[model samples]
Target: MSGIIALLDDVAAIAKVASASVDDVVGQAVKASGKAAGAVIDDAAVTPKYLQGFSAKRELPIVWKIARGSLFNKLVILLPVALLLATFAPFVIPILLMIGGAYLCFEGAEKVWHKINPSDHHSEELVSEKLSAAQLEEKKVKGAVKTDFILSAEIMTIVLNALPQDVSIWMTGASLAVAGIIITIVVYGAVALIVKADDVGLHMAAEGNSGFVQSLGRGIVRGMPTVMLLLVVIGTAAMIWVGGNIIVHALNELGWHLPYDVIHDLAVGAAASVPESLAGAVEWGVTAFLDGIIGLVLGLALIPVVTKLIVPLSSWLFPEKQATPH
Candidate 1:
């Protein structure tokens, strides 16, 4: 009787510990996931274009395919790399993060530059002209997956960096895995919804028995363009703010605290002058704006390097024109 009671007690104790660990893992995952929201938003905002020009029946299938690719990117590729970095190359995380931030800055700056001096949008049109429907679909999926890999890499790295310093290797891995799964699901699920919404609206408007349903369909069709534009604006803002914040934080970590300190103090002072109810909003807006400015400048600087050096190297390595058969 005594032995059985002791065994039960041990089991209960073990179960309690396991339960606590699960809670911690989930809590940390959620918090870490939140840290990558800027990237997450950008992912959601940018992905629907991959489905553009596809038939209504094909849109959901395309999104589903891309979502699976995103999962593979995060889970099979980036997650393992992230874990290895957390375990062996811990010191490299900050550097990689700074690089990623610079990339974000570059992308955001390009958007701003293009907006200010509007370039003809030719890629999609050209692709549409050159590729068959199947070929175009494949190309879009490949492009989306490639883009997702970059974003996933950044998200995983940020999540790894956000974890507690004393965390065990297994815990770090678990938290990151959960965060990656959750983020992938959230981003692509939202993307699926965004891509299919117009189709849903069209079906309802044309086939529905009710006039209100038809009107709603018309509204969705009209609203899609605006929604896509809003997404672009939001994505650009997020990239700049998040990128600048990462660089600023990296600077502080590297013992150059001046930029961060100045920004923090300025935000505090600005908040103090605002009404109590609006102080928090004012602080966040001001901070984000300043960060965006920094990101824009850094991005603009990188643009020349990318265009003159990186682009040429890539083109050289992967020439669009194939060699003729001997």
Candidate 2:
């Protein structure tokens, strides 16, 4: 009897420790995930565009496919890379972040440029060319997955950087896994909701037995366009702000601290000019504004370089076959 009780106590102690570790992992993961909000928001916002022109019945399936790809990107690819970087090439993290940040800046600037110079945009004449629905779906999924890889890389790095240095490798890996799964669920779940909102509204509008229900449904259908536009605007701003902040911080880490220092001082000055109670908000706003400005400038500079150099190099290296119209 005494021996059995002792063994039971030992098992209980082990269980308690395991429970505590699980709690710690969850807490840390949530906190670290918050640091990557910009990337997360942009990820969610950008995904819906891929579903455009697809039939209502197929929207959920496409979202599911992309979500699955996103999970694979975070878990199988980025998680291992992040762990290896954390363990061995810790110094490389900042460089990778800057690269991702540069990409984000380039993307945001391109969007702005295309919007301003709509005539300069690539002719989508090829879009109307005949392609089986299956082929088009495959093409879009592949493109979404490719885009997710960059955004996922950014998110993982941010989470890894936010973790405590003293934490064990196992803890880092476990926490990252948790964060990735949670974020994937949240982001794709939201995408699912956003994509299906119109269908649900249309159904209610068409089949609802009451006038009020029909009006509400119509309202949702009408409101979605504005909501989508707002999401795009917010996502673009976030990409610029986050990208610029990452680049500025990376430069500081790499010993080019002048931009960082200048931005800090400017934010502080702005904060000082405001009331003490509102100082923090003012500082953050000023900092983000300056960061966004930096991102815009850097992005604009890279625009010509990318169009003239990077795009040409990419096309040369991996020339895409132009599909002939049947």
Candidate 3:
């Protein structure tokens, strides 16, 4: 009886430790996920564009397909890469992060430049006679999955960087897995809702028996365009702020801290000049604005290099056009 009691106590202790570890990992995962919110918001905002022109019945199904692809990208492709880097090539993490951050900056800046210039919108859709509906859907899904891979890489790297190096491998893995699953679900689920909301609203407006309910439905339908616009605005701002901050921090990590310190000192000085009740908000806003400015400038610089030099070089190296033997 004594031996059995001792064994039971040992098992209980093990269970307690396991439970504690889980709690710790999950806590860290949540915090780490927050650091990638800019990418998350950008993901959510951008995904709905993939549903355009698809039939109503096909929207959710298409989202599910893209969501599965995203999960695979995060778990099978990016997560292992993240872990391997964390374990072996830790120094490479920050450099890759800066590259991803620069990408975000370029995208955000391009959006701003367009907004200021207000160029005429032109549809780029090609009416290929050989392409069927299935092929078209497949092409769109592939494009979306490709885009998700880039965003997923950014998110996973950000999450990995957020973790402490002292953490055990198991702890790190658990945190990453949890974060990946949670973020994938949140992003795709939001995409589904956003894509379907207009249809649902239209249905309710057309079919609802009561006048007040129909009015509410019409309001929802009318508000969706504004909602989408707001999401884009929010996402663009987040990309610029987050991208610039990442680049600045990376520079700091690489022993070039002047830009970081200057931004910090300037923000603090501005905050000190503000009213006491609103000082914190003022500081954050100023910092974000300056960071966004940096992001914009960096992005604009890259635009020419990327468009003229990089694109031409890449085309010469990996030409998408191949001569077919007739």
On TM-score, the leading prediction is: 2
Q: Which candidate is the best by lDDT?
A: 2
Pick by lDDT: 1 or 2, better one: 2
Per-prediction TM-score:
0.85, 0.90, 0.85
Model 3 TM = 0.85
State each model's C-alpha RMSD to the native: 3.4, 2.6, 3.5
Model-by-model lDDT, in order?
Answer: 0.83, 0.88, 0.83
Model 3: worst 10 consecutive residues (lDDT sum): 120-129
Model 1, stretches more than 4 Å misplaced?
1-16, 116-128, 207-211, 317-326
The digit string of per-residue lDDT tens for model 3 on 24-82 reads 99999999999988778878877776677779898999999999999999999888888
* TM-score of predicted structure 2: 0.90
Tens digits of lDDT, candidate 1, 70-150: 889888888788888877887777787788788888877877877785653455356567777887888789877876776
Give one digit per residue, the lDDT tens place, for model 2 in 137-223.
888898788878888998898899899999999999999999999999999999999989988899989999999999999999999
lDDT of 3: 0.83
Off by over 4 Å in 2: 124-131, 206-213, 319-326
